[model samples]
Target: MKVYEALAAAFVEEGTTDVFGMMGDANMFWMNALAQRGVRQYEVRHEGSGLGMADGWARAAGRPGVVTTTSGPGVSQLATSMLVASRARTPLVAFCGETAWGDQTAAQYLDQGRFAAAIECGFVHLSRGDLAEEVVQKAFYLARTESRPIMLSAPMDIQQHEYEDNGPYVPSTQLIDRPRLLPDPSRIERARDIVAASKHVVIIAGRGARGSDAGEQILRLQKRTGAMLATTLQAKNWLYGDTDYHVGISGLFGSRVAMELLQEADCVIAVGASLNSYTTEHGYLFPEAKYIQIDTAPNLVMGNGAVADCYIQADANTGLAELTASLERESVTIEGFHTQEVRRRLTAPLIDPSEFRSQPDLLDPREAIVVLDAELPPELDLVLGSGHQTDFGTMLFQRSREITSNYGMFGAIGQAPLITIGSIVASGRPAFVVEGDASFLMHLSEFETAVRYGIPILVVVMNDQALGAEYHKSRAKGLDVDLAVIPTPELGRVAQSLGGDGATVRTTDELRAALAEYVRQPRPTVIDVRITRDVLSVPYRRLWFGEDV
Candidate 1:
């Protein structure tokens, strides 16, 4: 058996059915072998997106994703996407092809191991043959340990070289030390005291707080304690569909009623959330609340100095569960906490009031999402970019549907759509990627991959022709706003050129009709909705306007 065979075998035993990568002359041998051996190989157009697809899939499926790339440029292209995955704290294992050992110094011999190290990624060298199993096992170990992306580079010779299987292989699941909550007694007492004291308490969740075995217990605590629940953008689905308390996202892109609850909170239990600068709205959103922060990582407590009266060094789920148990035993009536009134106040139904009040000719981005939300099948998967579009859509969409966005590390545009593309490929489902003008243009080329893969991805491009968030800021400051504008390529035309079904929708009626037609067709569709520039409003603008400094 060759080292590549062993590597692929390890993946099979580990339960990885799909592998994403771009096949180059350097990696063709191993890639083809893996494909024949039952691992479905996806040959993507760009190496960066290949990495992104795997990362997004990992995020959705709760497992480490596998990506392979050829040497030099192929590996180099993975650097940014890998960093994104790393920053988001996703678990992934990447296999990279390298030049033959003798050609290490050739101009094409860029050190991928060095590249991985630069990002503080766990790196192993399969540059040496016969030790492939050890390196492969270690790569999986590192990936699972910190839930970080690990890159392993195999030299061409090492992959091609044959090896003897000395012993029967056994897959190991060595239990590494899992992150635990410290349960500092005093801090728990303080948190316990805060909850005991406050009449109106809020438990705000972020991405870090989700998916622990303890999450449901925390939700149970919320129910037992009668606390209002809200989540950050990254943690949108953290509270699930219990809309009685789940009031959607908070801060810059938050709901007005959600912000009001946080502002008036007598005690804000910031669980698994960092309480970052945005989360606090630079200190205005929750000025009066005695903040209690809990997370797996203590270093991420953002309101560390001034506001956090109680910092519990425990995983949010564990800590919340412990606190809930204590509270229940003590007969605490953290009860009668319902947000039905808040939802009533916050819900702005978009149904046009008048039959004769002519709708705008250019599509309204908000209305487009409203229609898309109504039209989309309940089971359809959705991936949205981070901006006004996602902010609005997240609030507007049904809570039952699954929504993924780059909310943890929101910037670095053009990446989210690729993430969507990868997710659709990995899940093999009808997925949609919704993006603003700027975000859509960032990786417009990857839509070609959707067409090639026939992923049946319907891309809703909200073509407002500007950096809408900045433009909104410019308008708020009373500055010349057009300076925030951007020149965008005609997305529909580009989609058509790449062999996709494309349509330009101007009116709400046109959009409704286009989306209906788009989804029914047996091809990838890019529906470019020409949106009114004025329709883009920064989240919380409706609530935060005209406050004197």
Candidate 2:
């Protein structure tokens, strides 16, 4: 067997079912080998799309996803998406094809190590054909354990060389998936004391809390302590149902009600959350609250954001379970948090579309979202791309278990198109992506990939003819916003030209008709819904002015 064949064997050994990539001559051999071994290949239009797909797959599958790209430009294109994945704590293995061994003068040859390091991603080069399998296994190990992206550089010349297998293939999980850490007794006792003293408490859960029974345990802790439940944007649907106590996502895109309730809490027990600046709103949201943070790996902090006064270093689920058990020793500290008044306040529409004046030519984005929120099927997985439109859609829509957004780590926008593709492939279910025009246009090629593969992804473009967030912010700041605006094109007709279904919607009735048709014959359909720039999100209004309307 050759080196590429051994790499394929390693992937199969580790049980990677789906491989996403933009194959070039350099990586084609290994890609073919993987395909030959019955691994489903999601051939993307661009290199970054492949990584984006892997990130989405990792998010959906709860395991490491794979992407293979050629060297130089292929690896360079992965930087932004890789950073997003890193911020998202996604486990991804990107096996990139490098220049031939000792071919430093090649045009496409790049210092892949430097590239990976610049983006803070793990990279390992397969220098020896005999140890190719070792590097592959190690890449998977780092990807899984570190919960970040790892790149395995396979030199084209070395990839064709005979693989000198020293022994049988051992799956990387056997070495990596050992027993994890549990919460310390002293720390649990300390956290309990903190909660015991507090009259008002709040639990802010993050991606770390999404694993195991952490969500269930956190809710239990909340019930015992009468604490409010809030989640970072990354962990929005960890506890899905809408309730007064269940404060929605807290961040730059946080609902007004969530931040208001969060401000009143005395002790905020952040479980499995990073307690980053975004979630905390730079400590403005809970500036005076006593923060008792719990995580598996609470390291030495450099910034004021992650700096917690009482740090409980343990697994989120385990720590939460232990801390809840300890807190259960005592009765509820306080009550009346989930009062009827609070429930009414929480349930009130964040942005009442009726209040906002309607537009004549274009549809109000809020109104369109409201209609979509009602019309969209419950089963279709929903994804939101980043922008002001996202702020509207994310807050407006009823979150299901099958929801994802670019509102994760880096807030990267363009990857949603590709991420939606991967998500559609993984679940074998129809999905929809509501994205801004600028964001959708960034990776427009991926839409073509969806069309080519017959992926049932409904692409909803909120065409405001500008970057909605920046446009609103620039105007508020009294800056010239000419550069923020773009020439709005007929994206719906473009989708049609590419052999996909499409409709250009301006009114609620038009949108309803398009949605009705889409539900009946779901395909790669583009609903280019033009939204007026006159309307803005409630968060935007609050951020710009001192008003929370």
Candidate 3:
């Protein structure tokens, strides 16, 4: 068998059924070989979009996403997406082609390993054709174990060499060990003591709490301790139905009531959460709270420099279950943070009551989100793009299931559309991508890709005719806001030109009509909701102007 064929076989053995890529000379042979073996291939307009799609699939499907790129510039275009995946801890394996072996003068020659290191991605070079299977297996193993992107580079020249058949390839699943770490008895006792002694308790869940029975376990613990519930932004709507004591998302994107309640927490038990700066509001969210962190790798000090009084190193489900059982054994049930006033606060309107001056023909972004949230199907996957509009979408849109993933981890915009396409392909569910006008136009070409692939993704563009974040910032700084205020084409008509459905709506009624039509006939569509740029999002207003509603 040829080396490229062997690599394809190895990928099949690793259970890689879907891949995203754009054709390039260096990697085309192997990509073709993989496709011949029944792997579904998604061709993208740009290499960066392909990587973003892979990242999205990894998050939605709960597996290591696969992507491919050619040598030199094709691989170089992956910098932004690679860094995003690395920082977000998304599992991905990139199959990239290096320049021809020993051909330093080749046009596409680049030190691929060094580039991978610069982006903080794990790298494995396929120097020998005979080791192709082993190299592929190792890349998968590293990506799975580390929860980060891994690059597998093979030289173009070596891919054509003859390879002998080693025995059947062994998949990485056999070698991967996912043990559930249990909490120590002494540490469990300490955590219990902290919870029992505190007057007000709050339990914060993060992405680590998903994919297990952790949600139920967390609820049981909350009920036992009378603790209020909240989730990190990444884990938004996790405890959605617990309305009495649940205060929604915590941190910068949190609502006023949620942040206020979090500030008053006397004891905070963070489950499967990293307690990062954004989640903890830069270490000021829970000033008086005795912090207790529970996770597989519980550290004394978190990313925000907040010290935990107790750290329990265990799986979220296992640790929370044990804690609940321990409390039951002691017959300990404390009326900590559960009060009549707190219940009323939790049930209050989530959006700020402070009203902004309304524009004649433009809708409020927050109100637009609320309308979309109420109209869109509850089962749809939501992907949020980063910009000034992110705060509105994150805080206003509420859903029951916690299947949402944000493209704002790296604070980059214009990735939500590609990510949403991948998510639709993975989950086989309709999706909505909430993006700013500038962000949506970043990869408007991908709308054609979506049309070609027939992916059902509805992009809701919050059209404010500017780079919302920069525009707001420039105005606040008394700078030339015109630089950020670039006029955009009618996005709805643009989507139509790309072979997808489109609609431009300037009011809530028009927005509702567009959404209802899309729901009735699901397809690739874009609803450009014209929103006023004057009203600032709550988080942005607070952070930029020190004003709170």
Q: What is the lDDT of residue 148 in candidate 3?
A: 100
Off by over 4 Å in 2: 242-244, 300-306
lDDT for each residue of candidate 3 in 306-419, tens digit (9 for 90 to 100): 578889989998899888898899888988778898888777777653553448889888889888989988778788888898778888887675456563568878888878
Off by over 4 Å in 3: 298-300, 352-357
Worst 10 residues of 3 by lDDT: 349-358
> Against the true structure, whose TM-score is highest?
3
Judged by lDDT against the true structure, how good is candidate 1? Answer: 0.74
Query: For model 2, how does the per-residue alpha-carbon lDDT over 119-205 read when each residue is reduced to its tens digit?
Result: 879988999899888998899999988888998998999999998778888888889655668777887787788888887788888
What lDDT is reached at residue 328 by model 1? 74
Clashing pairs in 2: none
Model 1 weakest lDDT span, ten residues long:
350-359
Comparison by lDDT, 1 against 3, better one = 3
Tell me the lDDT of model 1 at 162.
87
Candidate 1: segments with Cα more than 4 A from true spot: 102-104, 172-187, 213-215, 237-240, 303-307, 335-343, 346-360, 387-389, 408-410, 469-490, 518-523, 540-549
RMSD of 3: 1.4
Ranking by TM-score: 3, 2, 1
* Alpha-carbon lDDT, every model: 0.74, 0.82, 0.87
